[model samples]
Target: MTPTLILAIAGGVLIAAGIYLLLERSLMRILAGVMLAGNGVNLLFLVASGPAGLAPIVGEDPELIADPLPQAMVLTAIVISLATAALLLAMSYRSFQLEGHDEVADDVEDAIVRRRAEADLSSEAYVDTSTDPNDDSDSESGGRFDGGRVR
Candidate 1:
Protein backbone atom coordinates (compact mmCIF):
# COMPACT_ATOMS: atom_id res chain seq x y z
CA MET A 1 0.00 0.00 0.00
CA THR A 2 2.76 2.41 0.95
CA PRO A 3 4.84 1.63 -2.13
CA THR A 4 1.84 2.13 -4.41
CA LEU A 5 1.14 5.50 -2.86
CA ILE A 6 4.75 6.52 -3.24
CA LEU A 7 4.83 5.45 -6.86
CA ALA A 8 1.66 7.43 -7.62
CA ILE A 9 3.00 10.52 -5.92
CA ALA A 10 6.34 10.25 -7.67
CA GLY A 11 4.67 9.74 -11.02
CA GLY A 12 2.51 12.81 -10.53
CA VAL A 13 5.53 14.87 -9.60
CA LEU A 14 7.43 13.66 -12.62
CA ILE A 15 4.54 14.50 -14.91
CA ALA A 16 4.20 17.97 -13.43
CA ALA A 17 7.92 18.65 -13.74
CA GLY A 18 7.94 17.36 -17.29
CA ILE A 19 5.07 19.63 -18.29
CA TYR A 20 6.79 22.60 -16.71
CA LEU A 21 9.99 21.88 -18.58
CA LEU A 22 8.11 21.27 -21.79
CA LEU A 23 6.61 24.77 -21.61
CA GLU A 24 10.07 26.33 -21.69
CA ARG A 25 11.38 27.79 -24.95
CA SER A 26 14.65 25.85 -24.78
CA LEU A 27 14.82 22.77 -27.00
CA MET A 28 17.06 20.93 -24.53
CA ARG A 29 14.51 21.41 -21.77
CA ILE A 30 11.81 20.13 -24.07
CA LEU A 31 13.82 16.96 -24.68
CA ALA A 32 14.28 16.45 -20.96
CA GLY A 33 10.58 17.01 -20.44
CA VAL A 34 9.72 14.36 -22.97
CA MET A 35 11.99 11.85 -21.25
CA LEU A 36 10.57 12.68 -17.86
CA ALA A 37 7.04 12.37 -19.12
CA GLY A 38 7.75 9.01 -20.67
CA ASN A 39 9.20 7.69 -17.46
CA GLY A 40 6.26 9.07 -15.48
CA VAL A 41 3.86 7.32 -17.81
CA ASN A 42 5.70 4.04 -17.41
CA LEU A 43 5.53 4.38 -13.65
CA LEU A 44 1.83 5.16 -13.79
CA PHE A 45 1.23 2.09 -15.90
CA LEU A 46 3.06 -0.09 -13.39
CA VAL A 47 1.00 1.35 -10.57
CA ALA A 48 -2.21 0.74 -12.46
CA SER A 49 -1.42 -2.89 -13.17
CA GLY A 50 -2.27 -3.94 -9.59
CA PRO A 51 0.01 -6.12 -7.46
CA ALA A 52 2.73 -8.10 -9.18
CA GLY A 53 2.02 -11.81 -9.46
CA LEU A 54 3.43 -14.96 -10.99
CA ALA A 55 4.86 -14.85 -14.49
CA PRO A 56 2.38 -15.30 -17.32
CA ILE A 57 3.21 -18.64 -18.93
CA VAL A 58 1.50 -21.74 -20.18
CA GLY A 59 -0.51 -23.56 -17.49
CA GLU A 60 -0.28 -20.61 -15.11
CA ASP A 61 -3.34 -20.20 -12.90
CA PRO A 62 -5.62 -17.44 -14.21
CA GLU A 63 -6.00 -15.88 -10.77
CA LEU A 64 -2.25 -15.66 -10.20
CA ILE A 65 -1.19 -14.57 -13.66
CA ALA A 66 -0.11 -10.98 -14.09
CA ASP A 67 -1.32 -8.95 -17.05
CA PRO A 68 1.30 -8.97 -19.80
CA LEU A 69 -0.22 -6.30 -22.02
CA PRO A 70 0.60 -3.27 -19.89
CA GLN A 71 4.17 -4.44 -19.37
CA ALA A 72 4.61 -4.96 -23.09
CA MET A 73 3.12 -1.58 -23.84
CA VAL A 74 5.42 0.13 -21.33
CA LEU A 75 8.45 -1.58 -22.84
CA THR A 76 7.49 -0.42 -26.29
CA ALA A 77 6.84 3.07 -25.02
CA ILE A 78 10.27 3.17 -23.37
CA VAL A 79 11.99 2.24 -26.61
CA ILE A 80 10.03 4.78 -28.60
CA SER A 81 10.67 7.49 -26.02
CA LEU A 82 14.40 6.78 -26.03
CA ALA A 83 14.53 7.00 -29.80
CA THR A 84 12.60 10.26 -29.89
CA ALA A 85 14.74 11.73 -27.10
CA ALA A 86 17.92 10.86 -28.94
CA LEU A 87 16.54 12.42 -32.10
CA LEU A 88 15.54 15.56 -30.22
CA LEU A 89 18.92 15.79 -28.50
CA ALA A 90 20.67 15.50 -31.87
CA MET A 91 18.44 18.20 -33.32
CA SER A 92 19.04 20.46 -30.34
CA TYR A 93 22.80 19.97 -30.56
CA ARG A 94 22.75 20.69 -34.27
CA SER A 95 20.70 23.84 -33.69
CA PHE A 96 23.09 24.99 -30.97
CA GLN A 97 26.04 24.37 -33.27
CA LEU A 98 24.47 26.36 -36.04
CA GLU A 99 22.49 29.06 -34.16
CA GLY A 100 24.38 29.25 -30.84
CA HIS A 101 21.24 28.90 -28.75
CA ASP A 102 18.43 26.44 -27.87
CA GLU A 103 15.71 29.05 -27.73
CA VAL A 104 13.09 28.85 -30.44
CA ALA A 105 13.33 31.70 -32.92
CA ASP A 106 10.35 33.42 -34.52
CA ASP A 107 9.55 32.44 -38.07
CA VAL A 108 10.47 35.12 -40.65
CA GLU A 109 8.29 33.34 -43.20
CA ASP A 110 5.24 33.86 -40.97
CA ALA A 111 5.87 37.59 -40.91
CA ILE A 112 6.17 37.64 -44.66
CA VAL A 113 2.93 35.71 -44.93
CA ARG A 114 1.18 38.10 -42.61
CA ARG A 115 2.36 41.09 -44.64
CA ARG A 116 1.22 39.47 -47.87
CA ALA A 117 -2.19 38.67 -46.37
CA GLU A 118 -2.58 42.27 -45.17
CA ALA A 119 -1.60 43.62 -48.58
CA ASP A 120 -4.13 41.32 -50.26
CA LEU A 121 -6.87 42.47 -47.89
CA SER A 122 -6.04 46.18 -48.44
CA SER A 123 -5.49 45.93 -52.21
CA GLU A 124 -7.86 47.44 -54.77
CA ALA A 125 -10.72 45.37 -56.16
CA TYR A 126 -9.96 43.26 -59.22
CA VAL A 127 -11.32 44.44 -62.56
CA ASP A 128 -11.48 42.23 -65.70
CA THR A 129 -11.57 44.30 -68.88
CA SER A 130 -10.15 41.67 -71.23
CA THR A 131 -13.51 39.95 -71.88
CA ASP A 132 -15.35 41.13 -75.03
CA PRO A 133 -18.60 42.94 -74.24
CA ASN A 134 -20.18 41.23 -77.30
CA ASP A 135 -19.65 37.77 -75.88
CA ASP A 136 -23.26 36.74 -75.22
CA SER A 137 -22.49 33.23 -73.80
CA ASP A 138 -21.23 34.54 -70.41
CA SER A 139 -23.96 37.13 -70.14
CA GLU A 140 -26.88 34.75 -70.72
CA SER A 141 -25.66 31.90 -68.48
CA GLY A 142 -23.94 33.92 -65.74
CA GLY A 143 -20.74 31.88 -66.44
CA ARG A 144 -22.33 28.66 -65.04
CA PHE A 145 -23.50 26.98 -68.25
CA ASP A 146 -21.71 26.84 -71.61
CA GLY A 147 -23.56 26.16 -74.90
CA GLY A 148 -26.49 24.43 -73.05
CA ARG A 149 -24.03 21.96 -71.36
CA VAL A 150 -23.53 22.03 -67.56
CA ARG A 151 -19.87 23.07 -67.68
Candidate 2:
Protein backbone atom coordinates (compact mmCIF):
# COMPACT_ATOMS: atom_id res chain seq x y z
CA MET A 1 0.00 0.00 0.00
CA THR A 2 1.06 3.59 -0.50
CA PRO A 3 2.55 5.47 2.46
CA THR A 4 -0.28 8.04 2.38
CA LEU A 5 -2.92 5.31 2.49
CA ILE A 6 -1.19 3.58 5.38
CA LEU A 7 -0.91 6.78 7.38
CA ALA A 8 -4.57 7.56 6.68
CA ILE A 9 -5.66 4.16 7.92
CA ALA A 10 -3.57 4.50 11.05
CA GLY A 11 -5.03 7.92 11.71
CA GLY A 12 -8.53 6.56 11.29
CA VAL A 13 -7.86 3.72 13.71
CA LEU A 14 -6.42 6.09 16.28
CA ILE A 15 -9.46 8.37 15.98
CA ALA A 16 -11.84 5.44 16.36
CA ALA A 17 -10.03 4.16 19.44
CA GLY A 18 -9.96 7.64 20.90
CA ILE A 19 -13.70 7.98 20.45
CA TYR A 20 -14.24 4.63 22.16
CA LEU A 21 -12.07 5.68 25.10
CA LEU A 22 -13.86 9.03 25.30
CA LEU A 23 -17.14 7.22 26.01
CA GLU A 24 -15.77 5.93 29.31
CA ARG A 25 -16.40 7.79 32.59
CA SER A 26 -12.73 7.76 33.64
CA LEU A 27 -10.99 11.10 33.27
CA MET A 28 -7.62 9.50 32.59
CA ARG A 29 -9.11 7.48 29.75
CA ILE A 30 -10.69 10.59 28.36
CA LEU A 31 -7.33 12.37 28.51
CA ALA A 32 -5.67 9.54 26.62
CA GLY A 33 -8.48 9.59 24.09
CA VAL A 34 -8.00 13.30 23.55
CA MET A 35 -4.30 12.86 23.05
CA LEU A 36 -4.79 9.98 20.63
CA ALA A 37 -7.39 11.89 18.66
CA GLY A 38 -5.15 14.94 18.55
CA ASN A 39 -2.22 12.93 17.22
CA GLY A 40 -4.50 11.21 14.74
CA VAL A 41 -5.67 14.59 13.51
CA ASN A 42 -2.08 15.71 13.16
CA LEU A 43 -1.33 12.59 11.15
CA LEU A 44 -4.33 13.22 8.91
CA PHE A 45 -3.13 16.77 8.39
CA LEU A 46 0.25 15.48 7.30
CA VAL A 47 -1.40 13.06 4.91
CA ALA A 48 -3.59 15.78 3.47
CA SER A 49 -0.59 17.98 2.95
CA GLY A 50 0.76 15.40 0.48
CA PRO A 51 4.39 14.18 0.28
CA ALA A 52 7.05 16.22 2.04
CA GLY A 53 9.09 18.61 -0.10
CA LEU A 54 11.46 21.54 0.30
CA ALA A 55 10.78 24.14 2.97
CA PRO A 56 8.56 27.04 1.95
CA ILE A 57 11.40 29.58 2.08
CA VAL A 58 12.53 32.19 -0.38
CA GLY A 59 14.35 31.00 -3.54
CA GLU A 60 12.52 27.63 -3.38
CA ASP A 61 10.12 26.82 -6.21
CA PRO A 62 6.52 27.25 -4.92
CA GLU A 63 5.39 24.01 -6.61
CA LEU A 64 8.19 21.97 -4.98
CA ILE A 65 7.78 23.52 -1.53
CA ALA A 66 5.42 21.83 0.91
CA ASP A 67 2.31 23.67 2.09
CA PRO A 68 2.83 25.30 5.46
CA LEU A 69 -0.88 25.74 6.25
CA PRO A 70 -1.36 22.15 7.34
CA GLN A 71 1.71 22.30 9.59
CA ALA A 72 0.41 25.49 11.18
CA MET A 73 -2.99 23.90 11.71
CA VAL A 74 -1.42 20.83 13.32
CA LEU A 75 0.53 23.08 15.68
CA THR A 76 -2.64 24.95 16.62
CA ALA A 77 -4.50 21.69 17.20
CA ILE A 78 -1.64 20.45 19.42
CA VAL A 79 -1.83 23.58 21.55
CA ILE A 80 -5.59 23.31 21.88
CA SER A 81 -5.32 19.64 22.79
CA LEU A 82 -2.68 20.42 25.38
CA ALA A 83 -4.94 23.08 26.93
CA THR A 84 -7.88 20.67 27.00
CA ALA A 85 -5.74 17.91 28.53
CA ALA A 86 -4.50 20.28 31.23
CA LEU A 87 -8.05 21.34 32.05
CA LEU A 88 -9.22 17.72 32.28
CA LEU A 89 -6.24 16.81 34.47
CA ALA A 90 -6.96 19.66 36.85
CA MET A 91 -10.63 18.70 37.02
CA SER A 92 -9.78 15.06 37.65
CA TYR A 93 -7.28 15.99 40.33
CA ARG A 94 -9.85 18.13 42.10
CA SER A 95 -12.42 15.37 41.82
CA PHE A 96 -10.00 12.88 43.34
CA GLN A 97 -9.19 15.25 46.18
CA LEU A 98 -12.86 15.73 46.98
CA GLU A 99 -14.44 12.36 46.18
CA GLY A 100 -11.36 10.13 46.45
CA HIS A 101 -11.98 8.79 42.94
CA ASP A 102 -11.96 10.00 39.32
CA GLU A 103 -14.97 8.16 38.04
CA VAL A 104 -17.79 10.48 37.03
CA ALA A 105 -21.12 9.96 38.78
CA ASP A 106 -24.43 10.20 36.98
CA ASP A 107 -26.52 13.22 37.87
CA VAL A 108 -29.61 12.51 40.01
CA GLU A 109 -31.58 15.23 38.22
CA ASP A 110 -30.86 13.68 34.82
CA ALA A 111 -32.04 10.27 35.99
CA ILE A 112 -35.21 11.81 37.41
CA VAL A 113 -35.85 13.65 34.16
CA ARG A 114 -35.27 10.50 32.13
CA ARG A 115 -37.71 8.55 34.31
CA ARG A 116 -40.33 11.26 33.99
CA ALA A 117 -39.90 11.32 30.21
CA GLU A 118 -40.15 7.55 29.96
CA ALA A 119 -43.33 7.58 32.08
CA ASP A 120 -44.86 10.31 29.85
CA LEU A 121 -45.30 12.63 32.84
CA SER A 122 -44.82 16.37 32.70
CA SER A 123 -43.10 18.28 35.43
CA GLU A 124 -45.31 20.15 37.91
CA ALA A 125 -43.86 23.45 36.76
CA TYR A 126 -45.19 22.95 33.20
CA VAL A 127 -48.59 21.39 34.01
CA ASP A 128 -51.46 23.28 32.40
CA THR A 129 -54.74 23.19 34.36
CA SER A 130 -57.01 24.58 31.61
CA THR A 131 -59.28 21.72 30.50
CA ASP A 132 -61.08 23.29 27.53
CA PRO A 133 -61.92 20.34 25.24
CA ASN A 134 -62.36 22.65 22.22
CA ASP A 135 -58.81 24.00 22.63
CA ASP A 136 -56.55 21.46 21.00
CA SER A 137 -53.48 23.65 21.58
CA ASP A 138 -51.87 21.29 24.07
CA SER A 139 -52.12 18.12 22.04
CA GLU A 140 -49.12 15.82 22.00
CA SER A 141 -47.19 17.83 19.45
CA GLY A 142 -44.03 17.82 21.52
CA GLY A 143 -44.27 21.28 23.10
CA ARG A 144 -45.05 23.61 20.20
CA PHE A 145 -44.82 27.32 20.84
CA ASP A 146 -47.40 29.74 19.48
CA GLY A 147 -47.32 33.54 19.83
CA GLY A 148 -44.28 33.49 22.16
CA ARG A 149 -46.01 31.04 24.57
CA VAL A 150 -45.80 27.27 24.87
CA ARG A 151 -48.94 25.49 23.70
The prediction achieving the highest TM-score against the true structure is: 2
The lDDT for every candidate, in the order shown, is 0.82, 0.85
On the 0 to 100 scale, the lDDT of residue 114 in model 2 is: 76
TM, every model? 0.70, 0.77
List candidate 1 segments past 4 Å from native: 108-151
Candidate 2 structure quality by residue, lDDT tens digits, 1-151: 9989999999999999999999999999999988998899899999998999999899988899989999999999989998999999999999999999999999987887777678777754344546574676567466564322355
What is residue 128's positional error in candidate 1, in angstroms?
A: 23
The clash tally of candidate 2 reads: 0
Taking the tens digit of each residue's C-alpha lDDT, what string does model 1 give over 1-151?
Answer: 6999999999999999999999998999999999898899899999999999999999989999999988999999999998999899898989999999978876886675566576664333233446787877665346653222232
Indicate the TM-score of model 2: 0.77
Candidate 2 scores a C-alpha RMSD against the true structure in Å of: 6.8
CA shift of 72, model 2, Å: 0.9
After superposing candidate 2 on the true structure, give the runs of residues whose Cα lies further than 4 Å from its correct spot.
Answer: 122-151
